[model samples]
Target: MAAEPQTTDHRKRPRRRGDALIAAILHATVQELEERGYAALTMEGVAERARASKASLYRRWPTRAELVMDAVYSVIPDPGELPDTGELRGDLISVLTRTARLLDGPAGQALRGLMAEVLPSPERMGQVRAHAQGMGRQMMEEVTRRAVHRGEISPEALAPRRMEVGQALLRNHFLFHHEPISDEMVEEIVDEVLLPLFNTSPVNSAT
Candidate 1:
């Protein structure tokens, strides 16, 4: 009898087909941004670089801000699902610090550059800010749920400012600076700043 052939999980394989055109255009946009910066990243240039049509690019991404944001996301990577490292602090540190590095590194510059252009267009700016806000909110919500699961604090203890602590880490470090936020820095910020500010202090029965 022939030995059974081993099989790899096709689910993990990279799948690119229908989305390839969008991916190619975004990839080209990143190159244009890196070489010519935002000022030169026109629809025509992106079309030329992507070997796609200007009409197609405009139909997909109507505005430069939209084009750049889509492109920037493709260039910079995001962290994977947050694993329970058995402690709330450790878990938040992992999620947030990775987030910080993403912002401080590749994505941040592009985001900042996008904002500079987007701000002039109020409608575009709102959409861009909303887009950014949605991502942070999702991550913070997960962090909060994990904190509750770890029995780190009373559910009510974290209720008031659950997002405040986690997102603030990203807001303060990434939005404000060029420094790559380190794990040690995240630990200190979470333990020193966040815990002290938001972690439950002893409930006094004397009240």
Candidate 2:
């Protein structure tokens, strides 16, 4: 009888580590979200897809929501200070347009899904808002500061409520309209709404 051929075991590959592991997990998470969506995604699925252990995933992310958020944020760029385009209107348009473009991608999908999942829990909802809205306000504040320095707008225009106007409109359109944001809409937002608001003098409460 011929000796039995030895079989190589392929199931015991070395585990991915450090940045490689993180990249694999994040990539797998996004793929799973795109394929299965937030409601159906689980740690087991992500781990299997990443060729990692469940323990590895759990060690990094304590909850499904956190993991999904991380995956989504990984692909999105931080909204650093806006470029000084010389004119306030141009800068505002640039900021709003960039925001609209980001919301048109996987980041948008992940956000919508997260809202649906976390809305029932006040704590989770607050966390999501802090991450999403907080960043938007921060970017707007920076842009507003730049405009002030350039003498494009009065310092009195830099109010908390004013900073939120652009992002609020953008988020409303995104959540309700279910369509890619258009340049016309962004222009309208800048020209019709934000520019007028910033240029107007603040009303005196004592009057």
Candidate 3:
């Protein structure tokens, strides 16, 4: 007698949760971006690669741009509290170097793609700048705050432009020159620009 035909059970992929799920999605995003470039990236493709549903991605990140930005930012080290090197210049250099290194990898590629796509849309450009510059500013603030506490700089030294100078110079070099930021360039920014801005004594005015 012939045996009854066996049935194949089609099962849905197991649900991924919490950090594991996010990690898988992020990894898939980077892989997709690297392989297909930003223009070819899609929510459907990422979900397929991640073995997750499109609903899962949309729930976390409402748009493709948001998802890509989050993936890029994930690789960047949190500024946290940096070690106090006991000097302003050393602290600035250390923090700036870290930022430069982050921009040299996947974050850099994502940024280039984001800029090209978003430049034509003012709203999108604003979103991109806020996401990118916000992190840099936070790092700079941490470095500068420590300097103030150490008496290396005064409260008056905390000006908006002064706080922004280090990251701005580093970003300018990266965006325009499109080269890996060098130790020499980092030093130049700290020495030639930031140090003077932070350390300079205010000019006295005669009434």
Q: Which predicted model would earn the best TM-score? A: 3
Query: Residue 173, candidate 1: how far off, in angstroms?
Result: 4.1
lDDT of 1 by residue, 1-207 (tens): 999986554334454345887988888887887787776668888887777767778888888878888777664334346676777677677667766776764466677777777778888889877776666666656666776777766565554345555656666666578567777787887787666544564353113
lDDT of each: 0.69, 0.84, 0.83
Clashing pairs in 3: none
Model 3: per-residue Cα lDDT over 112-145, one tens digit each: 8888888999998999998888888888888888
Candidate 2 — worst ten consecutive residues by lDDT sum? Answer: 6-15
**Candidate 3 ranges beyond 4 A from true positions:** 1-11, 18-20, 34-36, 201-207
Candidates in order, TM-scores: namely 0.71, 0.80, 0.83
Better of 1 and 3 by TM-score: 3
lDDT of 1: 0.69
| Residue 80 in model 3: lDDT | 77
What is the RMSD of candidate 3?
Answer: 4.5
